[model samples]
Target chain A: MDEAAIDVRGLSKSFGGRTVVNSIDIRVPKGRIFGFLGPNGSGKTTTIRMLCGLLTPDGGEGTCLGMDFRTQAEKIKEKVGYMTQKFSFWEDLTIRENLEFVANVFCMNRVSERVEKALKGLGLESRADQLAGALSGGWKQRLALAACILHEPEILLLDEPTAGVDPKARREFWDELYRLSEAGLTVLVSTHYMDEAERCHEIVYIAYGDLMAKGSVEEVIAKTKLKTFRVGGKNAAKVREALEGNPAVATTALFGEDLHVSGTDGEALKRLIAPQASENGLSLDEVPTSLEDAFIYYMNRAKEN
Target chain B: MFSRQRIKGLIKKEFIQLKRDRPTLVMIVMIPVVQLLLFGYAVNTDPKYLPASVILRDDTFLTRSIVSALERSEYFRIAGAVFSDNAGDARLRSGKDMFVITFPDGFTADVVRGKAPSVLIEADASDPTSVSGALGALQGIAESVIAKELKGPLADLAAVRPPFSFTVQKKYNPEGFTRYNIVPGLIGMVLIFTGVMMTAMALTRERERGTMENLLSMPARPFEIMVGKICPFIFIGFFQSGVILFLARFLFGIPVLGSGGVLAAALLLFITCNLLLGYLISTAAKNQTQALQMSIFVLLPSLMLTGFMFPFYGMPEWAQYLGSCIPLTYFLRIVRAVMLKGAGFADVAPNFWSLTAFVAIITLITMKAYKKTLD
Candidate 1:
């Protein structure tokens, strides 16, 4: 954590008299891609909104890039580039024109030169004259990012930048993010993809307006404290049905040909699954808990709370 | 309040966006000129040509002479002179022609006996203002011609019809010229055209596609954004105002009775108020469609309630009270009062204060609402 580029505590937000983001704390270091992961309505965007100084938290004190968020919002704004979930750009304007418009907003010196540099940076030189609306989803995203970074902000806040892109395209985007991070731009990105989460330097999982876990991807999976077992047989479906609703069973998910199950009390889970395994002639063995399993376990726990 | 550099950046950005939309800019200027022409030429209060039917019940020489004279007069056109002895009076109730002249069955014998012949002029009172003037003016010509004819026949004419009177004072425009009134009010419309079309598209655009968050996070304050958004419109608005004034003076030859400097100052205030109002609408709308619709809804009501079509003086008591609340109504009134009535600054001081307060209050509200962004 290099000087805690984003250090915040007890952040809370409310709208229409209901708390959307409750008391939460997050600390992100410089030059790292921090992934905010959670289900829909889990306050990931709201928390991101607060951290970037795009919004003021009702109850929080934080510094973004070593500036006080409440008082120095203008200063923080000058340093951060935020990519929203939605595609927002003038559809009528060409790619070059859109970049120029953003540059105008920043009032940067030598605007035409900066436009050339941004066009080259995003690999948008070939299509600079094309209308923004004519481009497909990936290109629109590239344009939005180019607009955000034209002023060369120190940090970038991406709210689900790769939501609908294909996996290959998503990989290409992450590569660009890694390159930007290596150049000393702190990144705070939110995504639900497990593999994408693993690529992050650290992960913060939030659910139901509460911060559930924060650590490296491997550490988060280990901290779930779940003992999982995999049952594979021709009658795995029947085994899943019988094991479900059992007090000892925490989760039962169909994974291709096998039924994966988990429970916090390992002894009780073993006792329950052993009988079902023998009756169905299914082979049972302890399995390494994947991130998806840990996520599901944590999500179900959040629901019961 | 914001830093000087940040405010400058916002202003520059706003100008760039404004330069992008051209069709809307054309519409703003077009609506005002079209409205001015529609109101100026189409709206005529003076009676130009009234259709008057004469039902001559008398077949005497004097009645024939009176009928011939009424036909030749410019005040009324003789549509049809039906013999009262032929068709019944049922046609009179159908409102065919404004006035009917019915002379009694005197024959020319009453004039020879030196007794004055009495003729009845029944006028249609449906639209009392329009036909009443024609009725009053026609009677003057008929009476003067009859008095001359009677003066030769009778020596003492003391008891003769005491000269039917025509008392008409055409207020505002004695010549009934269109350019006089329309040119003054067109100035206000031009301001609205330029100010509203520019500022209305600004904030909603950012919010519609999710770029507003990025802007809010920028080093720009809400008031700074607002000022930036309106500055470009103000310049355009003033330029349009100048064009309208030039058209009025050079093309139409309309007199600038009021202080040109004072008129320009009032126009600035009007445009400022319009920009502020546009900003308020933008903040209220979630998208461009919503903003555009709401602007129309507001613009239409303002065009009506602001006394653009009907005169504030001629309208009923309730309408005049409603007209006073509309900003455009007050602005138009001040512009017209200054340009047409030659009203000084002291006369228009109240209107200036009202516009100043309206712009100030709306601008403050938008600024306060914009500053309250949430996590």
Candidate 2:
């Protein structure tokens, strides 16, 4: 087993008498791409911010890169690259200038060489002189990532790195993350996209200041113990709508033309859906619980608690 | 406590941004020029070339000499001669002339006989400061003229001081040009605006644009960030001081009597203090608009209580204490003393040290208060 890159216990934070992050423990192994999944306002960004020393956690005790996260933040900052959820590079600065600035901030030598390499790596050499504010969303994300890796940081804490990007751009961005991870860099990325979450080596789901689930994608799904059944018929929508009001059914989500109904109690869910299934004349096939179904199950379960 | 490389990067970035910001660049150059011209030609507290009329009932050589001296004194321009007291009084009442110089009958004879008759000079004393300097000049002119006329056998009478003949030797600004006071003080005002407003906006703009979080997450320390951000404006402050001093010298005839090195050193300290204050303000403000609003809290007290607009000593005791806390009050004193009074380093050492202490204290506070994290 690899050593943990970020191992913190009882991490907590609050703002203005409202708890944003409860006492949550997180541990990501070195050289792994750890996914942080949560709905909006679920403190995913806050947790990422705290890890990179952009914000001070209200309560926590642990080490990042073998140093105390609280007392040795400055040391941690030297080795950590934090890409904010927002495009936080200077908008008025050109792409090359922005990269150069980051290099200088890290006090790296051969600034022009490094900036040029970053520009080329981003495939933005032709547009190096363009202002960052003028770039499209995907290009801006690339610039931000390029800036983050300029210093060759050991750990990358990305907060929703591809939030507003198109799917193709997002795919390319995840590929870059995987490449960085393969190079032995620890990556802790927070995202809302199911495909993105499924690509992670492991994922943690947090909701309402609580860590609901944490494991590999399949492990998280199995932990939910949700028995999901897929049904496709003329009355699929009617069955989905009818199962939503049933207490036995945990969650119902429509994927394309098919409906996925999930529940923690397999027998009770089957018993409740069989009658509706017969009435709608739709055949039900047991299916593996997907990451989205597991997440929705966790979200609903968290809301109940 | 600071890294040279990070500071250099911050300074370079700031310079580029400052260059691109056209309005701020224009303000940087235009503030000193516009303020100097506005205050130089327009705002004069000491009114000169005031109109006056002579009521010469006992016209003699002494009286004529005194009247001519008054005209040459440039404090008053003789509008005309009046035969009756009513006409002179009416002229003063109507504001046609600022003063009515009345020579009582046998005034010269009484002086010659050593009877000590008084020359009645009635002045319109409304708006006292406007007339105070001219009235004071009148005393000097009248005494000298009488002494010149009372000669030979009358030398003894001249030797004896006249009834109102206590001389006030106005030092430094003998003419009491208001620009002499104002022009030097403008150096402090210009620096306060540029140093405080520009630097106050520096960090706030970064935070507002969401760049501050990324910047903080870098290896650069707050000290490096603060110093780097403020270093570029130090040159702007020097350029502004140069502009104001140049205009003060050639345009308004104000002297740069102190040592250039001493003035420069003192100015450097004052400018650093103001910039540090602005940096401190930036730490507290959240956006550009908030920075601007916060800067006014500093600039207003600087303008009003720092002896810029009103006399520093004239403020109430508590207000004076409040004024003393402001760095500009010391800077205004230092700049004025250095420019007008030819004060050397030793002469202005106290004020210079006050600004030094201000720099030290504010630097400590700002660095301590500067947030390394968003918390």
Candidate 3:
């Protein structure tokens, strides 16, 4: 991380007396894909909007692309691309027309060439004449990405860009993102998918209005301090039930015949579940805490606080 | 295949959704209440106090009695006296007076000698229905007043061929066709329909479809977006205006008497005013449905109070003031004056300026209402 592309502090936003994002600080280095993860209404979208100048923070100070995000919003808007969670493009316009409209809005030079390049780059050239509304969810997401990058923005702020896409399409979308990132574009993307989050260089997890966790994928899991054990047995539900009542277990889930139990204190959780595992003639194996489990631990801890 | 429980659940859901839409709920209650008040309080078919300007070359007792009797009849208000017949004609052309009653010179001596002098009564008959009732009342008023004045000797004079004669000349529309008045005013109506209602729904559709958020997130300024959105509708409004003007000219045979440039300029100003007002409505409305409801709310007043359907001066003073505040009122005036009286730019300049002011005011308010941020 040589220099921060997006460096923000005390970024807070509220809607109608309800605080959506509060005092959230984020710093993403240039040319890095920073994942923003949160449950629904966790202010992931709110924070992104504030950074892009689509929303003014109730209380905050930050810089996006080295310009004051608040006061220099117009100038910053020139360099930053924002993709909303919804398909917020003109559906009536064809794919080519939509791109052309966006290119015109940005007042880009050589708009036709730029549009043709974006269409081909997004694999939309074959169906560029189709109305945007007629496209499937996966293709719509791709088109949104193409439109966002049409102006050659330095930073891309995507709010859940792949929320409803098929797995294959999502994989392709991420491949495009990687290409953009490698080409020196800093990306701040919000998503609910854990697999997508793991692909990011670093991630920040927000719960409700607070920043719960922030680090690289492994570092975030390490920060959670959660220990997980895989118990394989026919009595997996029984094992899960017993661990659910105990404070030592942060989260417990049954994956087929195997039960995965996790908690912050490794010693206490092992001590608590070891007897139960042997009593039921179950094999227990310690496993690294997955990001999903770490996130659940953060959520549970936030709820308790 | 419809289950009772499912139907009941759907009905409940619909009601809940409707209740949650506060703007629609408010519109539901306000539309009828306001409509009732407007129809009951403001609308009048047989308009009273039709302003009449007079040029009395014979201001004798008989002529004065005739003028006072016209006022007492309550059909005419007797606005003010003018020195010449040209001034009276000017008042009629400008729509300031509905009638111009002129008493010729030496009318008292001629009447006493049973000369049966001619009294010229010029009526602005562009809006035939509005002036018809007052015009019908004039002869009775003058004859009765003259009969009262020519008492002893005039009883004999009244006995034969009437004491005096008055010729009622209907100006602008000698044929007195109602279509002439309505067809010209239809230009403003069609403009309102497209410019206000359609423009409002178009903007709200963008917001509802979520395209507006995307547009706002771009490098586009609010003013640029507003202009781009409204410019297409402006063309649509002009197209509708052209259609109406074509129909008015061919179908209704309503003469396009004014300069084409003047009418086009007025149409541009009027259409822009309506489109800006629509933008203002869209800024206030949360969705397309609310935008439509608000458009109807604004439209009903323009239709009723702008002298489009009803006589403007016939409404109560407060309603007249309210009507004046609507751009359609000035538009109707300008269009009618231009089409019927062949008025020039100077004739309709006040109305053109009023519409311009409306555009300016609505533009400022819409700018304030339009939030650059989603907040």
Candidate 4:
């Protein structure tokens, strides 16, 4: 019910005769944490760039932060904070110097004060004098995040902000995002981790330049209409092999010691797996469909198309 | 045996990569050929056919014969004859002629009456090397003129030291000190070499480190970024120019004869022009190595053809035309005319205007080449 922060329709882009981003539409409501989930080379970074005015979409008409994305790109750029997929800050400069440079570029008053505030906010005060290149991966990501939000823009477009971060650091980063969102900042983040996707208020899955699905975590799962039955036993491998190519089953994947059999049709999937469960002495139990199950289903279905 | 198959495989891989890198391949093949042509034909130290002016006060047979004999020597080409010594001095100060031959009134009568007539030969000696060869030929030319002209009854004049004396005055640089010209030229060369190369690498370094994308995504304008990047180098340029000028004054004893204000203004214009050229090169180049190669390409031609190593007029017409287009050539003339000849603002206006035009054109081209949006 909140007003849309980023509302674009029919966005498309191509490079060297290949369509990298097809006619995809995206909408993120104000103050919501929106996650973009996709495989590698799925045009996630390209789409983020286009949304922030770093790139011009070949075909699209939209508005970001209440400004026309096409004609008023300069105005739009002023209100959006874009964090690149790479750690793009100056590596040779110290953390304080980098922050000061960005502050100066934005033409902010009280530069040293603002730099000190940003340093303290990110808990980077101790390493303020350290060169950015010498920091660990987590610290670099934190520094990039700190730099993007220095101007207090209305929206943040982060391209895989936590790609190579460790689990603990990733959790801390997500917490920071939650705090920012709580303070009414609209966040559009692209990520690959399923747990991270679950944390987002809404998620969109894209594969091979096409938008496969978009909704909240439970909504996306329910939209798939996927029925998953877990099989556990010493004969899990045999059960997996028997139910893999069945016409009734869409996917059979291993999850640790259990085999997940999923299909769109609930009854057919149950009926096909019952015979295998009985013959192989396997324990079969219907379980809730997970985001990973839906994602794998979408990925396989897209490959087929 | 030393694994012949592996060696062959490595060689094949290397060749394929080399072929794919078109810039490197072109540099490898073209650099040597270009260097050979530039050094072999375009550069000549023994400079001939230097332009000279004649001040003919008394038009006698002996004066005509002396002028004809000087022309036949092939070292001096008489551009035109001026009426007054002031007019001829202006021509020399403006670098129109390398030397001026002045035959005062009654010179031919004095020589025939056994009174030695003094012929005033004033030469521009800023670039001592360029005029040294031509000056050496003058003595031989004077002796030959007397030997050839004193025929029939006047042959005795040939035995008394040619019955004439040459008061050769080396104008601007009386001692013909080589450093007087070379030190000023070195200032231009140093500015070009460092200012252009450092600026050429500035943008490429950002792009290589992935920081350019971040900078572009910010609210900063293209002009703002360009100015920010170039201002530091401008300071460096002025600093370098000051250091060289100080050294030239104290260590080498090269005097700054003209107005310091004029020289400073010219230095500022020249430095800005080179910085703009470097920015233009950065826009065309894709990476740091390509930028460096581009800088070298510009540096080499300016060094060889900018009248720094060879006489500007001594070169062939085509080479001189090429030198006229280089910014360093104009800057060299401006610096020498100001520091050595004590030239004023009005004297070096042409070079000043040419450098200003060059700066404007290069700034426009560089602005056009720099794109705001990523493709």
TM-score of chain A of each: 0.95, 0.98, 0.97, 0.97
CA lDDT of each candidate? Answer: 0.74, 0.83, 0.88, 0.89
Docking class of 1: acceptable
lDDT of 1 by residue, B1-375 (tens): 679999999999988876765545655776676566535543444544456676666686666777666666655667787776324233333323445666666635665565555566665432345444555566567666566655643534435443222233333344556456556666766666556656777888877666677667667767778888888888888788778877877887766676777777878888888988888888876678667856775575465555454433333345446666667877886776666556567667777888888778877887766643633
Query: Which sections of candidate 1 miss by over 4 Å?
Result: A278-281, B1-172, B190-198, B235-266, B286-301, B304-307, B315-326, B333-362, B369-375
Enumerate clash totals for all models, in the order shown.
0, 0, 0, 0
- Model 4 chain A scores worst on lDDT over the 10 consecutive residues at A241-250
Instruction: Rank all candidate structures by their TM-score, best first, as comma-separated numbers.
Output: 3, 4, 2, 1
Model 2 misplaced regions, further than 4 Å: B1-164
How would the docking of model 3 be graded?
A: high
lDDT of 2 by residue, A203-271 (tens): 999998999989999999989888999887776888887776778788898877788898889898888
List clashing residue pairs in candidate 1.
Answer: none
Cα lDDT, model 1, residue A145: 82
The runs of at least 3 residues in candidate 3 whose Cα sits more than 4 Å from the true structure, single-residue gaps closed, are B1-20, B152-156
Regarding TM-score, does 1 or 3 come out ahead? Answer: 3
Give the range of the ten consecutive residues with the poorest summed lDDT in model 1 chain B: B86-95
lDDT tens digits, residue span B1-375, model 3? 889999999999999999898888898899899899999999988888889998999888888988889899888899989999778877788788889999999988898888888888898889998988887886788678866787775678877777787789999999998888898898999889778887787667888888878887888887887898789887888888888888787878887898889999998899888988888888888888889889998999999999999989788889999999999999998899999999888777888888989999999898888889877
Instruction: Score candidate 3 by lDDT.
Output: 0.88
User: Candidates' TM-scores?
Assistant: 0.70, 0.78, 0.96, 0.94
**Candidate 1 or 2, higher DockQ?**
2
